[model samples]
Target: MENTVDQNGLDEAIIVALGCNLSGAYTSREALLEAALEAFSSEGLAVVARSSWWTSAAWPDPAGPAYLNGVAVVQTSLDPAGTLAALHRIEARFGRARGELNASRTLDLDLIAHGRRVISDVVMAPHPRAHERLFVMGPLAEIAPDWRHPVSGETAAYLATAASIGRDARP
Candidate 1:
């Protein structure tokens, strides 16, 4: 994660979700997480809050291995594109190689939300799938329990609980 200061020096905060399932993906699960944190520090991004790593059954394919998930709030001066780029860089640093959608991978970093931006394309704030993912909600609630969806206004904890039940029902 590389940081680029804005000309105005204004800081923008963003929520990020992290996950990993492959063993040899990046040395170890713990090390992969550490590498992420180290990248945040290296980029000079301020860590507002962070949740502990969570282990959950792989979605759509429980037979695969469980995934270690986490969420964090960070303050950066970079814009949405810059922030997204930094996240990709961090994932690449951990040996992540994107393949089939939802397929097991080394490391996964998602730009869950950035302020109140409702963007599309590769950088969608208030991620379209975030409210329905317990893995994201569980960790997010830890750091921002009262957080409401910018679009739906639903609470984080509520979404997390709903996801826990809905996850099993999904085809």
Candidate 2:
């Protein structure tokens, strides 16, 4: 679908994606990030805040190069599932191959939070793993430090700190 913004401003939401490998033909990390952002914006999502890409060692599997991760706060009318499906389509367009749970790929877009809405079917709410992943929490805390998890009731900043401590304790 062609990217277009509606006349009335839509509600805001935050989306996060990690650029781990240009597993496809694309070679630059910036290009991947731009494309992902454009895909979302094209769907009438307005980006409010963005975070700098953080380079991190691979997780779950370590064969691929370190990942470049960032987050974007967007305004959109689409429901949680709709927004997520849009992100999935964008990833597919960039040649993201989905298989194993934590395999590396060119694009990985996650619906971090959706305006306090908690959804559990097919698409999990508040991203079940958001608090535990440094790559996600770091950027999220940067943009919404005071934001509270709809379910856990913990502040983003707290979760981020916990994630950092968890990482340090790991081998």
Candidate 3:
């Protein structure tokens, strides 16, 4: 199981969701995600556990390229905002351009949760809508099945099963 508590008795399960439909400079979405994982370590996020890649047709538009998604449990000393900044930097490094709400991109990295935090200002922890998306919850469940939502108190596995979005997401 992924470590839930660090030596300081603080929750260490920082969750990050990754997805890519456009490969950019990389030859494949899988390679893009792999490079993003490596980028995390340089930003001080230590990956403890990672889920196998999951695939699903693009949401709200199945005509778009299918996406490769996954989740990782990371340990980080940075606060939620810092972690978010790091994720954005990693995304930018991979040619991600923020414009449309759900436009296809070379890479997408979302800070799903920072331990059990529930921050609402600047950067929201326990991302406001992640619980409703199978692309996020399904991969999260694979790595941290027992992880409970800071607000809902529901397990990752339960949320994945009950997710209303990305219903076709699969590993």
Candidate 4:
């Protein structure tokens, strides 16, 4: 998916997935998530549509705190890399720390896609692993059921049903 998208005439939708298992500074996971959504606008990202928070048991360790997850359709002027960087910044503001793989964190913001663009350069658009996780696809489907995968052209609803990971995910 290493390709360039023209930033000049960009009119495609931007999609992002949000997840969190720990509340960090916030008193509740939902509050942390809500604050993150607000931060998006501060960073110049406009959230056009958002899915309701979904819940799932911690993967590989169901005994851990359950996760709250959702997806957002955003409109931004920045390119894929810039968009990813903004997401990271927003995550960091919520105390997200990049450590072990899939470690529980305060915030997890993933750039699922930048319209139909397939970028594999500084950032990966149409996030490489999103399709495999129901936690990601399910919420995405809830908001945009007919959205097509940039590469496979599969509808978000179909992908959500076909996802193998996070089978316990629910809204």
lDDT of 4: 0.87
Candidate 2 residue spans exceeding 4 A from truth: 1-12, 164-171
Considering TM-score, which of the candidate structures 2 and 3 is the better prediction for this target?
3
Off by over 4 Å in 3: 1-11
lDDT of 2 by residue, 1-171 (tens): 212212132223445545555546666876777777777777767776776676677775556576777777777788888888878888888888899877778898888878777889977877888788777777766766766777788876788788842252111
Task: State how far residue 61 of model 3 sits from its true place (Å).
Answer: 1.2
Which residue pairs come into collision in candidate 2? Answer: 3-42
lDDT scores of the candidates, listed in order: 0.74, 0.69, 0.87, 0.87
lDDT of 4 by residue, 1-171 (tens): 112222332337688999999999899999999999989998889887888899999987888899999988888898888899999999988899899987999999999999899988889888999999999999988877878889999988999999998999999
Candidates ranked, most accurate by TM-score first = 3, 4, 1, 2
Please give, for residues 40-153, the per-residue lDDT of candidate 3 as tens digits: 998888887788899999987999999999988887889899999999998898899999989999989899888778899999888999999999999887767878899999
Candidate 1 structure quality by residue, lDDT tens digits, 49-105? 777788878887888877888887888888888888888887787778887988988
Show the colliding residue pairs in model 1.
Answer: none
RMSD of each: 6.0, 5.6, 2.6, 5.6
